[model samples]
Target: MNEQSPLIPTLPQGTPPEDLVPIGAPGGLDAAINPLGAELWFLRDRDGGHLLWNGNPDIWSGRAPILFPIVGRLRDDSYRHDGHVYRLPRHGFARHARFTPGAHDDHHALFRLEDNAETRAAYPFAFALTISYAITGNTLTIGAEVANRGDTPMPFSFGFHPALRWPLPQGGLRAAHHILFDRPEAPDIARLDSNGLLARSEPSPLEGQELRLRDALFEQDALIFPEVNSHAFTYTSPGGPAIRLQTENLPDLGIWTKPDADFICIEPWQGHADADDFSGDIFQKPGVIVLPPGEVWKASMSLTHERSA
Candidate 1:
């Protein structure tokens, strides 16, 4: 694992800030990504009513956001490192950090965010984070690679949050849709407390491979799976065909939606939030990925637009 991508991506001149790199397929799948957060904001499955959830103000402001450094809340929103205290907001800083366009072709776009003076003040680590999005036919694959550019190993957590249309613009009972898991899931999913910290586990509402989609299920908060047996699932709705996410190198899972929201987020994570009764050093926390100097930690998830069920 001695491969390193270029330091930055070259953006063609006259590219607008709102404009995204386009990835299209002859079968009618189209998508675009913005440099800000290296986020996938727009995804169209041929017919084009927008397959990804449109950011509704009352609901959520994110379409597909990448979570990094730390996957969830730290106790009191702060942590200690090397005998010094640091404050980092929930989900770390990757979502808010502006990534520089690395190298991109017609079907793939790579964006990189490296440690700088501003990041060092908060994170205190010299590392590089690169996110790449690729499209092949109706499939969109997102890849995140963390490189420890420093002499010491870098400890970090990573996650992916992708919200799809609940009922879809194609139209049905938001509850009519259901998530089809590749294998039978455990009867219980992990739970998070009011402060966004994880606590004791709870029995899951699911009995089989499919969990019927419903708004009421998230009345309290998110449904988290600390260790899911399968890493892939497909979302099916009568309003539209199935939208699938197949993952590699991602073991944790979360299903969440705001109160009465018309979207559901299927999140894949390499780590989770801090424990409710635990407060420890940042690098010692559970699920913290340690990358040796010059070594790379990478994960990829593929989103596919499937034919109607």
Candidate 2:
């Protein structure tokens, strides 16, 4: 394959924003990135509340900022807090809000979001969320920072969802891909129900293989992996460079692909979907984080593409 710049349409200042971009051609890297060619990056705005892509916070990408997915969806966009229920949009309001652009050079850019009246009404907290994207050689580094600005404590979760091109030789319903991890023990897989809620699946070995993606596999929605050992997961084609994702503090990983769809979502999360019998307390939610008054919490992960030996 030729080493060509990813295709993305240029959005001059003041143009209507678009989340998807073409990649993999000349002068393409500067265009907004989409999954049609290779990989696309997504990020959230200053408020960290909007979805930015599909009006859902968990999935986002666009032309100017270089789309990358972030956050997860809360059921009905509602969660219980101290016995009071607060309603938020699908992935909260972070992705839709305009972000303050961070200083950048030629290869990288940074964006930030915060919580205010609009955010407080839905989630009731003041906070800051900063996301940075940097590219060096063939690797991309992504980082996120969250700070609590409320007088009282706050509870929340965070994560990343990236879709990479399946560089296999053939494309069909029976196409297979191999996934390998850096850890010894396989992470616990959480099976999603018909309603998209997650439940624990039977523990299985992390043996490597090229498994076909069939329609039957997605009947359960997504494969959620908890108890991961801050390691990396790699996917490779028969004769292509490996696509690798690494995490440090994140403890959860989700692997999902739409049935008959052209792409797969490799999601790294700090939190997860609501449980089947959830009581609604935000802190009690699985993988939820509790921040003390004026306290701050941070979590991040990175992705890289490289040739296999």
Candidate 3:
């Protein structure tokens, strides 16, 4: 993969406006990413079919919101850093932040965010976060790059939250859809308490190789697998359209959907929310990444659409 990024179209200084970066190859995947939070607004497959959730308000308002600085809810919605407590909202502020749109060369586009007064007040770290989306053939790859630009170390968590159609654009009923793992083994999922923090690891209700989708299955909220045994999985419907999700360098996975909602999210995460009983430093938080000064961290998730019968 080429690391060189194409220059994104820019707006004049002091211009009041909304800018969106569009990137994709000519004959395959095409997508639009919102600079605000660097969120993906659209994804078009080779067949010109949209595979991402359409963000209907009746089901869920969110599209694909990135989880940065944190993946899930924090204990008390706050964390201790250097003996001082910093308050961060659930899923962190990256989803709400405005990112600087970088260059795009048709096949890929980049967006960047840096620590400022607001971020430092909550994160207290000097860092730069860059996100890039690339399309190759029938695959769309999303990468998150975190750099500790300051002289001190930086600690944080990040993840991708892409909500796909429950029945899928390929067509099927929710109950008729199922997820098949590349590995035969089923991994345990940590239950969430009333507070939404991880309760304990329990044996998954999933069957040997496939987990059928059911509305009641998400009544308790997201199904989080802290110890994900499979790096890849194929999401299939009754017939035709399907998508294969591949997570590289990301270890955790979360499958979530609201009760009776039209979309379900397959999340690839680097870290998860803190445990309910735990109240510790952000650096020591479970699944947190501590990058030394001048160091960079990277993780990616790739989605491939399969329409072959």
Best by lDDT: 3
TM-score leaderboard ranking: 1, 3, 2
lDDT of 2 by residue, 152-265 (tens): 877777766665544331322225565676766553466766655665576543554323444556656776778666368776555544567787677877776656544456
Pairs clashing within candidate 1: 8-102, 9-101, 9-102, 9-103, 188-204
Error of 1 at 41 (Å): 0.9
Candidate 2: lDDT over CA atoms?
0.55
lDDT of each residue in 166-190, candidate 1, tens digit only? 7765656677789888988888888
Q: Estimate each model's TM-score.
A: 0.91, 0.74, 0.91
What's the distance in Å from true for residue 305, model 2? Answer: 1.2
Q: What is the lDDT of residue 70 in candidate 2?
A: 22
Question: What C-alpha lDDT do the candidate models reach, one value each?
Answer: 0.82, 0.55, 0.83
| lDDT of each residue in 137-204, candidate 3, tens digit only | 88999999999999988898999999987777666666788898777665677778778888787778
Instruction: Give, for candidate 3, the lowest lDDT window spanning 10 residues.
Output: 2-11
For candidate 2, the TM-score is 0.74
> What is the descending lDDT order?
3, 1, 2
